[model samples]
Target chain A: MSAPAVAYPDHLRARVDDYLRTLRFPSRAPRTDGLEDAMRYSLLAGGKRIRPVLALATAEAAGVDAPDVLALAASLELIHTYSLIHDDLPAMDDDDLRRGRPTCHVKFGEDVAILAGDALYAEAFQHLLTAQPGEPARLLAAARELAAATGVDGMVGGQFLDVAGVSDTPEDLRRLHALKTGRLIGASVVCVLLLAGVDDEAVVRWRGFAGELGVLFQIVDDILDVTGTDEGLGKPQGSDERHGKRTYVTEYGLQGARSMAAECHRAARDTLSVVAPAGATELEQITDFIFTRTS
Target chain B: MSAPAVAYPDHLRARVDDYLRTLRFPSRAPRTDGLEDAMRYSLLAGGKRIRPVLALATAEAAGVDAPDVLALAASLELIHTYSLIHDDLPAMDDDDLRRGRPTCHVKFGEDVAILAGDALYAEAFQHLLTAQPGEPARLLAAARELAAATGVDGMVGGQFLDVAGVSDTPEDLRRLHALKTGRLIGASVVCVLLLAGVDDEAVVRWRGFAGELGVLFQIVDDILDVTGTDEGLGKPQGSDERHGKRTYVTEYGLQGARSMAAECHRAARDTLSVVAPAGATELEQITDFIFTRTS
Candidate 1:
């Protein structure tokens, strides 16, 4: 009924993987003593690659070539990977496994893991600034977008709220999700729009789509945490519950959360309709993928 | 003999302090639940504004206005502050104090401390890209310089070596300090040159000076770690010994390390003589400060 969730663009993800794989870290000395290995281990650790795939799809929907946005799109994965490494530290979520392997800190020692995360965070900005193909002004704008979304007001701030146990109310829970997860997801889309120099009106419309997509993504993540397997999720299932962290599912029951996801999907589709309908097939497919993903 | 250390430019440091003081972090919601407080707490905790002051001094030495480079200069301090926060984490150095106050993790809890550090890292790039007045290309190049010095090849990589206990030999220790402390210090000068668009030849000469400055700075740091007081350092003195870490002083002994610092100071002066001599006074003053500072 909902166009039978099109398969995640495995072909596109493969391309992204190849690009990431070919990249080399520059070191003052010829070797970084496996610091790069810690970074690569987590970066190449298999995930859905949903954030980057979203950036690529958004590029298409915005009438920009996917190749043109590949590096910028991939930079988001770097930030996401760094966050995972830090978030898994003993002091935070204390995750022991990630993507079916020992967590970064568990494998590399806590110090290397911390340094690896810091390196990746710096590399994300470097890659976006140096590798992305665009006008410098536009690239700067894109960099600023990425920075704003990752900073205290966005992902890190949201993380603070989550760790502080301050997001008790449903309203607070929504704010937490928006800041922690939603902002970076939105930036993945917005950065492409900025690079493309989209008109302000079009930006506003696409932002609406991005906003809904972020909401839908987080809700699905919460649902999967409840309805997933440890193997399938590539980490422990029930972590949210184990941590007693408030989630959409905790605020709204399971069925209610599903309803919210469905609502977001419809809203995303409706917002896409407001833009020119020329290259939106991939975006719609991604929306379907987000709604129906099991893990 | 060395002009009495020129008072370490407290007036310029005060300007950097005021600039950093007035920076208002943007948030989607009105409040970030003290995440900014955690960031501000460490950022304002006070260190000798050495890196930013180096940047400002470099700008002046290159015949550029300090105000033009102030934001970029201040950005270096942000990176320095973030590195300190992470370094003091329980999983890292496990320190309780920084700048005479409780370490970020000690004050804010580990999770908040980690997020605050991450936030500061993002904000460093954000502040540089948005606030520094320059051509976009030049600004992007400046950003890249900061990134290179902060990432795997530079500070973080150096930290990795230190934590891994790999720098056993004098040569490896030199490499470690160069990467860990020297690169960021060098970048404080290099970034200003990039933004100023100095000639390549001038860049090479300035880089030589910066390199010597970095070496001299680290040796002095090592000396202070041994001879300094806890009250003087605002953190525990003799931490390198307590941690069983290798340092210039550990390798060379206190007197030998002091001689090396003096040698680097001489080299820094010789390198500056290769460049235009009209604007070399502040740099010479800074070189003397590095050579003589006890804390």
Candidate 2:
């Protein structure tokens, strides 16, 4: 899980950041003043932007140009943002802080937060639906994939299992994490492949690789919640254990959880070898970063 | 605003009810155990089934057979049910009761309720996406329309405005209700038009008619919320006022609101006459029902 520090070249990272900035809320209609500002409040609050970065990096790795993949990458990030807003509502996780700023509901009230989420989700699909002329079918496929990943059988379903106290076994834990975190990551890679017009075999292999990476990400996140500092993490630490959450850190002890995460990262890197043989060096670098990231 | 009761015929109403029951939750996959049950809980919780009924009735009135329109009608209802479930979450309206029973989140946990809503929303499109192959484009159009209506610019946006607190201006009040309540109803009629495969100028006219009817229906709902009793309405009275919501009744006095509703109902009836010459009588009957209903 360890590799040399290979920072994303400043120019490429800057372009990714620029794409993210364009993904913020559109200005509100004159009749609906303040709506855009509310939406932007949560969206602009800093975080890794990992999902979009994954989309772009994978698309580039698959030979798609940066300009061709920017919208798709932003769409993935919008979907991720919407999920965070809804998840933080008082009914769900009820958190006030997200990314070291007030959660959507806390800043704009639950109604606006809910609407903001709905808007972001819709905008994500709209972005896909109205993609470049030659990209309609691919966009539609991406939209369908995203809808399935975020809806009943995916993120929402995983949340249900989590809150229902159903993730008692390792299999249940895997199912929860796969749907909760893995599907979006998987879809991000799949979207890149679709955009790049990659072969089905490569698409499937990439999805498998991304899914493993997603689970590893979640496992590492759980570990961070226990071992990381609040300043470093940008959100509360130890809340998972406090909330009686069924994280890997809770199900397995700290050392066991660390070992499980390392194994997952190794499996992810192994999967990536088949999917991106030409980009294997970069994939390994990402794996190493995920394994060791403090936040 | 008043008219004598005109039966829809027991056979027709019973047929629609039966169709709704079957469509409540599509047969679940083995892994979707609790998801199926959570969806069914609210879908089966009886209301007038107004949205689905409106869809089916409009289709039949436009010359499509009721059975032929069943899936489309059911899809519309699923969206409505999903909205209700999400709306009742503790983060939203937080009502414990709906349709004389405990709300989904009250009966199930918040997470299940959220999943149920997401599943129902997903299933609505899933049903449309997998519709019988007669009119794939129409199905796709309807799915897209449903997505737009339920997302930010329609129901969700209206909800945002509602929660943000509107002023006493009549126009502001109307805008709020139009989004919150009118759009889904408009979508219902649009679904019928799409499913019926109607392409005449009549489609445009009926959409206009349905949009006005949706506004009228919402105004009547506001009046009822303030004036109707628990037994008649199946929920608490004045709940909107209790929440400090700005409704038609709040912005205008009772008499003023009633007069506005009457005018809208008449306009709706007039538009229906232009759109559905064959079904004008039935459409007018529905308008009358909306204007005079206790709930």
Evaluate residue A167 in candidate 2 and report its C-alpha lDDT on the 0 to 100 scale: 77
* Model 2, runs deviating above 4 Å: A1-17, A23-31, A131-137, A194-202, A280-285, B8-20, B23-35, B61-69, B131-140, B192-204, B278-285
Residue B195 lDDT in model 2? 57
A165-193, model 2: which lDDT tens digit per residue? 67768888888878777888888788778
Residue-level lDDT of model 1, residues A1-295, one tens digit each, is: 2235567787778878888888777686655858999999999998878888888888877778899999997899999999999889988899999888999999999888988999999888878877899998999899999998999878888888888888767888888888888899899989999999998788888888888988999999999999989987889999999998988888898999999999999998998877746647778878889888877
Off by over 4 Å in 1: A1-5, B1-6
TM-score of chain A of 2: 0.92
Give the TM-scores of the predictions, in the order they appear: 0.97, 0.88
- Model 2 whole-model lDDT (C-alpha atoms): 0.73
- State iRMS for model 2: 3.5
